[model samples]
Target: MSSGSGVQPKVGFIGLGIMGQHMAGHTLAAGHELHVYNRTRSKAKTLVERGAVLHDNPGAVAAASDIVITMVGYPADVEAVYFEAGGILDKARPGSVLIDMTTSSPALAERIAEAASERGVTALDAPVSGGDVGAREAKLAIMVGGDGMAFEQASPVLRTMGANIAHMGAAGAGQHTKMANQIAIASTMLAVAESITYARRAGLDPDVVLDVIGTGAASSFLLNGLGRKMIREDFAPGFFVHHFVKDMTIALEEAARMGLDLPGLELARSLYDRLVSDGFGEEGTQALYRVYNAIHA
Candidate 1:
């Protein structure tokens, strides 16, 4: 329903992880009927306490709501939630909307859209960027792909969770856009790590260096935000290293499918793979700085 329609759609949210929780929180705060489910029930505790209805499963949430949004972890998880028995596609009523906010395979997004259409349901692949901070502030950049009308209907709900939201094109376009975003981020993260490492190696204050160069030719969101995090050595999970690796893998796989050779992306993936192998997968991606730091030390 459009914001001006005076129709409040019942909203369901699945996957209450680092970003999902805040997004779902924003949806609830906007006064819609909010239903939620997560594998780890405890993660839904605060939201439930805040008047959200916590269901036993994804299907239950789907059956109960008018519009369902899933911000699950992996493509596999997205598959299970939508394609499994008693899943969203199985239980959602005809004419309802399904939005998968997970960063997943473009092919899978297209598959979900086709399956939903067959059942008279509208599906959109609307993956997001902006990490935990963006979600918390309701300032995420959402890239959506699906029917134009469906995007219009979902805009009001999407607005609660993001500041910059766009309907990219048909099914899979949103995911393709996200892959491009990840590819850019993959290499930028490496540069951010290396730049800070070099600054420190030369005995220059990284914060001052940041202040000087942050607005110059080398400026970027990752360089300014994650760069500072790297300088402070705060490796918390704003966006987990493992998750970034997963995005990079998906981008690399897509590139190969399209006959592209992205060497910079490949190099970044290798470094992040090492971080995961070294048991730092749970840390934020800024922890890449530690790898450079250790090498310089």
Candidate 2:
């Protein structure tokens, strides 16, 4: 609860995948006594070498830390980590905090909050954006939803991993906000890919076009960041294509629940689905360019 100098919380981090690895590292570097768990122990090697305590399971991590955070892959993974036998909710001490940073279901976030409350633990759905680079640089934008008091209690620890952090509302609000984020990004991704494809077909240097258009109203994080990655053919998973598809699916489902229609998001999802079908799921979202190329071919 203390945010002052030299105060370090006992923090437990589960999921050491792409962005999680760097986020955990930032927490450890900020002086927290870090406990970590990953399904693949090999992924935690660098953090363990830097003095983090590695645990065999989520429950172990929760048992050992004052605050426990999970940044896993899917809604099912989220449910398993929090509700399975020997899970975090089963082992986390009373009054401890649980933060799920996965872009997951709003319903699931509400479920976790209710379960955590029943057991005297505080829960926050604190999904993040800014991809692998942001995680590595500790500049992620963290959107949090839960009790206001819990958000305040976790602020300093969250600060270690993000530059832009906001408490959206209660329980499921964070996930809803994240769904909104994904919806907006969905259309922009297609646009960015199409724009680059257009520039390339016109025989204008795409990089030069990026320099001009990226400074105009056409600019975006996708344009300035992932655009370069696309231009360089860097299809590595800063944020994977499959993952973005999952996010868009969640957004579409959520929108449907509210009796809304989003044609652009639907189109983006269809293109990403094609990418997945063609074996580019593990590639970065910048692989949207491949879809454009395939279409124009």
Candidate 3:
């Protein structure tokens, strides 16, 4: 995806939320002409002021760029942007490639791939891990589900926003891989929060236990990052509790459909549902600490 001569890639970015804001900025900063769109117009204002062009709708952004990148929150939203009446496919050129960077359903990914292929447009499901911090620092791990040529075409733009760019088989594979990631992390996050809470209850300094435990076999990004936040009571959302809850919901559906029993993932999903039901849905997932707080308080 390297540039040839002075002609840099013309990039399109939609979904200007927290992660999207930082991501689109990277493309603009990388000297690509970024055409941008967002549901709420004000979210795109800052980037437009910085010389990124704003489109009134998704179709407008697609019509203007060679590559269209989407990172909206939900599967329906992702579909609506790409295939809705007046969506990107309606206006994009035949050869333009679409990369869905949203962590969404494998079914939806395949659906988009089929639809795009019919129109001579290539599409990939390239969901990502590494929360807001990863996006800001360009250190995200991107799992792409598409063919080699499309991956090659989209790599430069993906590289501007992520560090680990892996091509996971065919279309829908990236999202399947991402669901596996979320499922693995789900219970681990609960354990991380529960362990720290147990330590605090026993009058042991959490920092001391975190220092010791994080050095042992139990260490993870969830442990290190969430542990630090629990210590400081900084429950701000790098990844919201609501979003992880949504991811778990998707994984659970996938599991049930395949006749697989995911007990651990279910437990974590229950924990998040409790968190959301307890009115902590808007808080960062590290606020899983509040669960133990309810019992220990």
Candidate 4:
């Protein structure tokens, strides 16, 4: 199917989680025919109501579209949607483009790309950042890796959902970029938590400390956002602790495969493991502040 530019790309979106919904919405808003699928059909109802066509299965979604984008939870889920009995790849056309937007492992991304290539489908490992807020606001940061032509073909659609977009390299580069994103986020969260805890124990107003330091060289997403959450004792999940921990494990695994060590990332992973062991796995990544709370308590 042709898009508005005479090459109307009929797009299929799988995964209707915190991010996928908004990403898919952009396609529909851009005058593209969008077919959406989700394991939970109920989530797709709203999109359907908004004029997006909802398919009952992955295959149906794939069959109806030219470009298929997936933003499932993890590597396993990616495989399930693309390689399972009724996976999208089985129905997607020979020249169709498949982009995996999940922040999965580079190894898994590479394997999927290779699989897609064998069947004559172009695949891109395009993991995203900017969090849930970014998705909702159509301001995500996207890192893409795959065939250059495929990236170019997907960029306009991608740009609709992201504020920053980069072509990292060949297949799996986006996931590798995301691993670095996760590592930095994981490490920063731990450091910010520790800093706020020390500030509070020193009898300083944590908010004021954040206000002052958040403007200095010490500022970061964690320092500004999580710092406020820490002072208020809010454990609400911005990004879940469970997901961050899993990302850390993938990073360390990749590091080992490359015969290296990511000490800072390893340290953050340990802290998250401890948080999970204490039954905080379901809490927000900001809940890492609880670890420092316990230390001061």
- Once model 4 is optimally superposed onto the true structure by TM-score, how far is the C-alpha of residue 236 displaced, in angstroms? 2.2
lDDT of candidate 1 vs native?
0.93
CA lDDT, every model vs. true structure: 0.93, 0.92, 0.89, 0.85
**Rank list by TM-score:** 1, 2, 3, 4
RMSD of each: 1.8, 2.0, 1.9, 2.0
Top lDDT model? 1
**Candidate 3 segments exceeding 4 Å error:** 1-6, 295-297
Ranking by lDDT: 1, 2, 3, 4
For model 2, name the residue pairs that clash: none
| Candidate 3 TM-score to native | 0.96
Give the least accurate 10-residue stretch of model 2, judged by summed lDDT. Answer: 1-10
TM of each candidate vs. truth:
0.97, 0.97, 0.96, 0.94
- TM-score for candidate 2, please give it: 0.97
Expressed as tens digits, the lDDT of each residue in 255-285 for candidate 3 is: 9999999999998888889989888888888
Q: The CA-based lDDT of model 4 is what?
A: 0.85
RMSD of 3: 1.9
Error of 3 at 25 (Å): 1.0
